[model samples]
Target: MSWLVTGGAGYIGSHVTHAMCDAGIPVVVIDDLSTGFAEFVAPAATFVEGSLLDGALVEDTLRRNGVRGVIHVAGYKYAGESVNRPLHTYEQNVTATLTLLSAMQRAGVEAIVFSSSAATYGTPDVEVVDESTATTPESPYGETKLIGEWLLRDVGRSAGIRHTSLRYFNVVGSGSPRLFDASPHNLFPKVFDMLYRGETPRVNGDDYPTPDGTCVRDYIHVADLALAHVAAARRLDDGLPVERVYNLGSGAGTSVAQIMTAIRTVTGIDFEPTIMPRRPGDPARIVATGDLAARDLDWTMRHSLEEMVSSAWEARRQAGDTYPR
Candidate 1:
């Protein structure tokens, strides 16, 4: 089946593109290269350089390629940056989604796998959040993602479109050697960059309510996350549900200290990190309850913390410099 991936040159999107290619699926990619690199797009997939806000471009690309389904991964993602620039985040994350949905409707595409985030559930009252958890986004990035999910849900309620919103936590690891590209915005890549420059990684906060007094998150390997998308695509093809949402995570909370330890252990970098105060809107712990995803999508993450860190390190190493430098 032919597919279109909106942010196909991005970190997670590139992995998804590679996964589809490995499965012998025809794919078309559209990326604006804002944060994504064109080199990361899989060689097997057709690439279009443009933004999702370009509705005409999105529509033309979808119709021309005979795209049966779309995996929407295009948008702004930095939590801290979103807080500093709410309007930009809303425009890119929320407004762009509205345009994309309109374009999808125009193209008569019936299936979509939206890339959502755990941020939508914003500092859940429960230690582990599931699909049934209440959403209270603390950042514009999170709020916009939730808005995108709502748009899909509303559209699905009235239109013939079927959707699966995958709310991700900390998406780690690299896909293939060719598709591996690092983002400076993420924790692992920032740490990798610091270590590469013979500098110690800086931890934003060390006084959270967690065991290590630091924020905790569920880190899922990017490859496994992509596989989960594939599973969701298969389920949609089977006509199981018109609209569904699943939180994609490992169900294990890894703190900042644990991440630092993993990086040093995996990369043989014996460096200490400088701890500072917690950033605003930082959650103490944000783990996932992937039971629903496991039951419905039959998804499981196979890579460990060490495996994910090592893959990211290898990818950074191969890049010769931090991506988008």
Candidate 2:
């Protein structure tokens, strides 16, 4: 049975496709290439270049590929920008997901692994978030992610479709030199670009209430995240019971200063980062405990900060200018 991975040309999605196919699972990819590159998709999979908004194309892709399940990773993923463009965010993430679900139901596809985000939790007054953290999303992007989860929950109850949502913290690093995170808003790429250009990386704040005097966040390797997706999918494929939502994260988190130190160490940059004032409403700390995921979905922080930085650097160098600026 073939598994359909939407947005398979994207950074995380492409990595997910690679992980699944490496396990000898048949895979099919559908991506519009809006923010994704067509070159990132693996040639082994049957690829369809299209958007989830195109209902007919989605249905056709599912039916044609005989997809038994879907890994719904397609969405407008920028949280900060979603605040400025809420309509576009909802249309792409929420409405587009509805379209995909409709096609899945029509094609008798009953299993899905939704790519949810930690943004669904917003800023909570908790030390470490778990699956049960209160979901009060602060941005359109986070709201859309929550709505996608709601869609899966409601649809599952009504249609008997087995599904799960993997809500993760900061996703960084690359599994292969051929694949790297190309997001402009992401920390890894930003620092990578600066160092490559012989510029000092900038840290937003360094006076937060933390050991390192910087905000702390869970940072998981892209490869580790991909492995969790495969594990979740495997559970569904084997008819094993799994939770509706799993938080893929590190129990503890790395601070911005810690990250900067790692980046400097890895890149051989002698300069320290410039510390600017914290952005409005930026929390000092927000980490999650992946105990549930660890028990069920084989989730773990398999890569260290140094490893994450090194791998990302290697991939960015490999991509050269082809990587997004």
Candidate 3:
């Protein structure tokens, strides 16, 4: 039996696919090329070009591929942009997840590892958040993700579907030179893109209470994040107990300014970032403890800030002209 990785052609999803493939897990990837590149998918994994919104296609893929579990990762993931595109976010993240769960039930697929987000704990007041933190998502994208977790919980209760949601923090770095994060909204790609074009990187809000007067975020390498997903999937496959939710975090915070410095050092690009006004709804700091994930999924920050920057920069440089504008 194979595992189905939805959105397996995207940055994080592709890394997960590679991790699974490397671990000898047969994988089937279904992705709509909206934001994913087909070439990013692992060569060993079967590729299905479609959207999870298509219930018929999803169910068909499950039945035809002997799929036993799912790693649901596809969604409209821009937290800031979701403010102006609430409907699109909900449709993609919420409704599409509903469709996927319904399809799984019909196809008798009994396990799922959801690709959740730290956005679910928007602007948490605590210095370090755990799974017990209150989920008061501040954006439509965050709301959709929290809703996705709720759906999985309810489904697991009624249908006996084994599941776990990995609420990871800012995922950065590239596992391979060929697989790069191409998001126009994420920090790493944005700065790298600006540098490639000989433009100054912009940092929003440098007047915060942080050490460097910028937002502090917990950054985890995409490769490390992928390993946790595989561990959760294996736990499901082996019928081992799994938590309802786990935070795949670094247990530390890095400010935007620090990230820029790391980028500068890694890329050997000496340029000060252009500081801008604070974006609305921006949190000063949000870090989480990965104690639970560490205990259960062998989660840990395997890469340092330098590695995160250097790897991403290497991949961005490798992409060269093909890197999405």
Candidate 4:
């Protein structure tokens, strides 16, 4: 039986699909190619172009491929933009996930690894967040993600499905040149687009209480995140214990200033970042503890700040127009 990876054409999902294939697992992908590119899906995996909203299509894909598990990474992921489109966000992230879970139950696929976001904790008061942190999402995007988690838990209780969600913040870098961050809202691609167009990168705020007077945020390499998903899947397959949720993070995070310095060094650019006024509700620092993940999900920060910048820069340069259109 194969593993079904929804949105396997997306940056994170594509990496997970390829990583699962690397582990000698047969993989089947279901993606609508909405924001994701069809080219990103690995040839080794069977690809089905469809939406998660189409329950019959999803169930057909699962049954046709003899899928034993699911890795759900499909959703509308822009937090700020979600404010203007809450209905779309809820439909894609919540309603779509419900459809997926229902189909999985009907098909008897009992395992899943959900791709979640740290945005679930809206401006957390704690310096370092763990699974126990309160979820007070500040945006529709985040609210939907938390709702997705609740759906998973409720379904697990009713159907005995084995599942876990990995909550992460500021996912950056790339696993390969073939894959790169494509979101217009993501920091890496946003910075790369600015620099590539010979424009100076702007720091939104620099007067925060962080060590460098800029926001300190966790930015994990996509490959590291993908590996954690692989570990979660393997444990579920092997009937090993796994947590309800894992925070994929580096305990100590990189600040905006640190990111600027790394970009300057990696791209061989001698430009200093331009500073602007702070955006409202911007926190000084928000990081997460990966101790639980390290113990159970094989999570680790395999790339340093410099390595993350370099790898992301290379992939963005390779992506060209794919970065920002």
Candidate 5:
């Protein structure tokens, strides 16, 4: 049976699709191409262009592909932008997830790996976040993710569906030069786009209570993150024990200033980032420990900061004018 990956044409989803394909796992990708690129999908996988909001289409894709499990990566991912568009966010993330789950149930798909977010923690008071950290999401995007998790939990309990939710912050770097992050909301791509056009990158709020007076956040390689999803899927396929949740984190933090420095070093361009006022509700630091994932899913920080920067920069440069502005 094949595995269905929702949003498999998106950045992180495409990486997971590549990893699953590399692992010899048959994959079926269903994406609406809303923010995802159709060309980003792996050539080996089956691609279905549709939205999860269409329960009929989702169910048909799953049954027709003999899908045994799902990797739910499709959702409204921008936490900041979600604030102004709460209803839209709920429709895309929460309502869509509900529809997907219902479709999965109808299709007899009994396994899933959800792409959750650290935004569920919402300016956590603790220096480092763990799975036990209370979820107090401040944005509609985060709340929808938490609601998705709740849906999974309730379904798992009632329907005996095996599932796990992976919580993470920033995902960077590329495993293939042909694949690149095209999100306008993400930091790495945003900076790379600015540099591509000879525009100065801006750093918001450099006066935070971090080591370098800038916000410290967790950043993990997208390729490495994709591997964990494959591992988790394997565990489920083999009927092995799996946790309800895992944090694919770095167990350390990287400051914004440090990232800028790495970008300068990688690009071999000397340009100071323009310091702008801190955006409201910006947290000083939010990192997580991936100890559980390390033990169960072979999770590790395989790529260094410089490698992350250089790989992402290379892919962004390769995309050139082809990437959507």
Candidate 6:
């Protein structure tokens, strides 16, 4: 059966696309190229340059490709930026997802693997959040993701739409040798860019209630995240359930300072970062419990910090003139 992966040219989506293609699955991609690269799209998959807001286009694409499932991964994802542009967050993430779901209803495409986020949990009192954790999103971006999950849940209950919403934490590392996160919003790419220019990466906050006082996040390699998606797809194919929500993460918190140290260790750069005030809407530490993903999808991450950092560094170097320089 054919599958449609929205935003398949993006970093995480591209990795999923690669994994799907490698498994000999027929895949179709729909992306507007707003923050994604056209070149990053897998050549084996059919690509349609469009927006999720276009309901008619979405329906038509589904019907034409005979798409059996969809992996929705299109959305705005910068916490600080989402706080500033809440309207943009609602429009692209919430509204666009509703449009896509509506189109899915019309097309009768049931199974879907939504790309949710750990931000949906916000800053909890607990160190690690699990699937059962209450979703009290702190930022507009997080709220939008929670809204997307709600859409999936409500839609499934109302209509017979089967889905899996994979809530991911801090997604680090590169997917392919060429496809990298070129977004200015991400931490790893920004840090890599700074170090590449012989400059020290800026530390946003260094006074939190953590070991090093830096904001700590659960870092999962992009490839590991892709494997989780693949596993979810297989589970749905086995006619498991109507809806599932899994937390894809390492369940370990890695501080920003730890990440910087890893980068330095990988690249041998002794660049010292300039500590700045905490960016608005950023929580101190957000890690995952990661039990549901393992139990439900039989998924686990296997990339070390050094390996992840080294891959990202190499991808950054290859991205040289290809990236928006």
Alpha-carbon shift of residue 38 in model 5 (angstroms): 1.3
TM-score of 2: 0.98
Off by over 4 Å in 5: none
**Residue-wise C-alpha lDDT for candidate 3, range 133-245, written one tens digit per residue:** 99999999999999999999999999999999999779999999999999999999989999999999998998988888999999999999999999999999999999999
Error of 3 at 233 (Å): 0.1
Q: Backbone clashes per model, in order? A: 0, 0, 0, 0, 0, 0
Q: Cα lDDT of model 5 overall?
A: 0.94
Q: Which stretches of candidate 1 lie above 4 Å from their native place? A: 322-324
lDDT minimum window of 10 residues, candidate 4: 316-325
Off by over 4 Å in 3: none
**Per-residue lDDT for 139-174 in model 1, tens only?**
889999999998998998899689989998888888
Q: Rate the local accuracy (lDDT) of all candidates.
A: 0.85, 0.92, 0.95, 0.92, 0.94, 0.87
Best by lDDT: 3
Error of 5 at 85 (Å): 1.0
- Alpha-carbon TM-score of each model against the true structure: 0.96, 0.98, 0.99, 0.98, 0.99, 0.96
Query: Which digits, one per residue and each the tens of the lDDT, describe model 5 over residues 1-325?
Result: 9999999999999999999999999999999999888888999999999999999999999999999999999998999889999999999999999999999999999999999998889988899899999999999999999999999999999999999999999999998898899889899999999999999999999888777899999999999999999999999999999998898888788999999999999999899999999999989999999999999999999999999999999999899999764
Q: RMSD, each candidate, Å?
A: 1.5, 0.9, 0.8, 0.9, 0.8, 1.4
What does candidate 6's lDDT look like per residue over 1-325, in tens digits?
6899999988989999988999888999999988888888889999999999999999999999999999999888887789899999999999999999999999999888999998888878787888888888888999999999999989998997888899888788886679787878788898988877778789998999899999988899998888888778877877885336788777777999999899889998888889999887677888887787888776787889998998988899998966654
Residue-level lDDT of model 4, residues 1-325, one tens digit each, is 9999998999899999999999999999999999999889988999999999999999998899999999999999999999999999999999999999999999999999999999999999999999999999999999999999999999999999999999999888888987888898888888899999999988998889988899999999999999999999999999998899999989999899999989998999889888999988888999999999999988999989888889889988998875553
List the candidate numbers ranked by lDDT, top first: 3, 5, 4, 2, 6, 1
User: How high is the lDDT of residue 10 in model 4?
Assistant: 95
Compute the lDDT of residue 21 as modeled in candidate 2: 93
Q: Which runs in model 4 stand beyond 4 Å of their true positions?
A: none
Worst 10 residues of 6 by lDDT: 241-250
